[model samples]
Target: MAIIECSKMDKAINSLLSRQNYLVTQANDLARSFGNLTAFEHKVLDYCFSFVKAEDTSKQIYVVQMLDIIRHLGLNKSGKNYQRVAEAFQALNTKTALYLRTYKNGKNGIIMTSLFDYIEIIEDGKIEFQFSQKVAPYVFELKQNFYSFKLSELSNVRSKYALTLLKLWNANSMGKLNKATIKGTLEEWESWFLGSDNEGKPKRWSAGRFKQRVLSVSIDELGKLYPKNLFELTVEKSGRKVVGYRLDIIQPKLHCQIRHT
Candidate 1:
């Protein structure tokens, strides 16, 4: 338990979050619940990451002023409409549950848990919490591949799919499948959604069903989040049958080039 002052919290906005200075989250393609976090929820989570320190394990508990957050989110600075804000944090407290991959007894396993180790609302305009200790190694000491981006870029995204794509995309914004273009059989996608959650109730989804339910809807949202062509998706087909997807991504500088061309 430690006290993070207001100065540290202000750095999320008041300081520079260059492309090099970004939030690094553990990569879990099969992540659900938290993966499905709504846009507002993702915004708040990015705000929280502004105060997290990868080097300091003792720096757990974070004090966030809701008023600053409100202004940052373009909400009325003087309004008493705390309910909306309350519900958003309540979702953070309740719905950010996830299942972390772990190994025990030389076997694969999952440890079901929530993002925050614990959360408490101190006042109508503030809240505090500790990140789970087990995730520190994955989030902070990221040595291998992990998803990351300037936290400032994610603040205005209004689509959950956009946020999910951001997580699935690499630092360069490439949509990769094991390191190259994504091309998998339509049948392979079913287990992904089914295994998305750990509740044991698997959801059956066909390629056509998934397109209508998820893919087709996510296109524009990505444009709003990325400059342009920072990420793009194309379909792969086995003759007439839709097999998988191929995502094309480019550097931030190339965004303007693609747009102009």
Candidate 2:
């Protein structure tokens, strides 16, 4: 059995190696047929075109060397006959011409555009590029539609948590307890018990205080109000007697309600 498994593994390895070699051979054949070109050919062509009309002696020599190599490999013949090579050269020429024209119009504009693409600002304010004018309307429509659906989904989700919170709040309510009622309701409860100055907003609830409040509420009340399987309770700060209860165990959702006094 071990020998059979080993042989099977070897066969799989050989199959993969054969496929890879076949792909490499096909790629080389394709390259040779297309003006005897490789990926670097396009890059070299770009560099040559940058000085297509230059009087600079060194640039002239570089362009001459590139053209000579193309002629030596009969690439001109391939480019003339092959559709792919013709199309590639056409694209290269178009882009090179546009780049030269743009550069001539304003070298500073090219430099600024390149800098804008590379640098990101993150202080004080936010700025971003406008979408292409042609696509802007459609892009905004799609974005608005997505956000509308997302907000609806979020509202539906929040309603579930809201209902659970309301039930928990009502379950064990005492007329006027000085402590927090529901763990999440600490700020509201504090304001009701203490005063407006004490409980400002939900953001005031620290993680430790939030955890303590959630645990203070009975597990039975939590289970009755919210899905029982969605929560778990465990002792935190083991040396201390305090136990922490987590709502939405798999993906806990704790919503705090704050009321201003």
TM-score of each: 0.66, 0.17
Candidate 1 lDDT at 248 equals 54
Assess candidate 1 and give its TM-score to the true structure. Answer: 0.66
Residue-wise C-alpha lDDT for candidate 2, range 178-225, written one tens digit per residue? 111333233333222222221222133453664445333433343443
For model 1, residues 30-133, the per-residue Cα lDDT tens digits are: 23235435678767776776675645573467888888788677788655645566677887776555556555685444455566787777765678878777
Q: Highest lDDT: give the candidate number.
A: 1
Deviating ranges (above 4 Å) for candidate 1 = 1-33, 78-81, 141-148, 170-206, 224-230, 237-243, 252-261
Best by TM-score: 1
Off by more than 4 A, model 2? 1-219, 226-230, 241-261
Worst lDDT run of 10 residues, candidate 2, spans 110-119
The global Cα lDDT (0 to 1) of model 1 is 0.54
**Clash count per candidate:** 0, 2
Residue 160 in candidate 1, Cα distance off native in Å: 2.0
